[model samples]
Target: MSFRPVIISLVVLALAGLALAFAPTGTTARPDQGDARPFQLRDTEGNLVTDTSLRGQVVLLYFGYTFCPDVCPTELGYVARVLRAMGDDVERTTPLFVTVDPERDTPELLKGYAPLFHPRIRALTGTPEELAAVFKTFGVTARKVPGAGSHYLMDHSSSITVLDRQGRVAATIGSTDTIARSVTTLRDILGKP
Candidate 1:
């Protein structure tokens, strides 16, 4: 028994070391832009959606939970600020809010939450499997933790993904930047085509 425990500890340490050695060392990892595969996700209306649904526009995707105490609200506010700065020019941009905590964030909940931001913004949720698939494709990681009873809180990447008219990820905007820069960057991308 002692020998087995010792061996297990060594194996665990080795695995940890390997993980640290190979782990990515940045806030965002660039995806192969050439691999512009389309993805399907549901909107707050429970309607089926696809990447093409966002054609002829610049799409901003933010993965977060409504229950998020601080980050979600702040980021959404930033998005709102950016939109406000754009004024009428914001028509060509679409902002999507994907809830990482789907168990509690239903379509009805999103209906109430999404409108709190700019009118152009929308919120979406799907089954765990559906969300997992989309998250993986977007390289977003999320998890739910116990809180009280069946209730839980979620953690996810705060980075926002910006997709061009071609439905390809053109650039990523993190939470670190000011709303002004974010709006400028988005407008610059929209000006391209």
Candidate 2:
């Protein structure tokens, strides 16, 4: 019998554990404003980009690997749908896909992968150490675990951290949130009163 199913089950269970580590105990339901952590990483084009450079834009940052089985693809697809529905409102936003598995998710690989979700998506990656730094700053942890033979998967925190026009983390929506809720969260932060 193949161990693939068992390994996939373990990966899902492990991901749940990692996700619980960052789960909030607070009752606060809305995205709160706060200073955004700064980190420099290489974008799809190989140019260095910093959190500070994202000021004046609503930045939606998601940390996951390209190989993520479901959450990554589903969330990206949802974000793409939201962006499409937003029409020109997307111009004021900067959506970033930061890879937790930088060892295999190089700039070139991400360049090809990110746009599949949204045309404006900018994929970011860096050296393993650099990726570690951002993960630390953002209070997320992801680790590779043995999967089926000669393969592995990453278990990472599951949430989308959204920054406001000032580049501060103004809100956080669940990775599994409905598209409407996700859009509302973004609009609340990025929209005019």
Highest TM-score among the candidates is held by which one?
1
Cα deviation at 90, candidate 1, in Å, is 0.6
Candidate 1: stretches off by over 4 Å: 1-16, 21-27
Clash pairs (backbone) in predicted model 1: none
Which pairs in model 2 have colliding backbones?
31-171
lDDT of each: 0.83, 0.80
TM-score of 2: 0.79
1-193 per-residue lDDT for model 1 (tens digits) = 6799999999999999999998744336775556454777889888977788888889989999888979999888788888888888789999999888888888999999988987888898887788888888788878677889877887678888888887888778866897778888888888876
For each candidate, what TM-score against the reference? 0.84, 0.79
RMSD (Å) of each candidate, 1 decimal: 4.1, 8.8
Q: Which regions of candidate 2 are displaced past 4 Å?
A: 1-32
What clash count goes with each model?
Answer: 0, 1
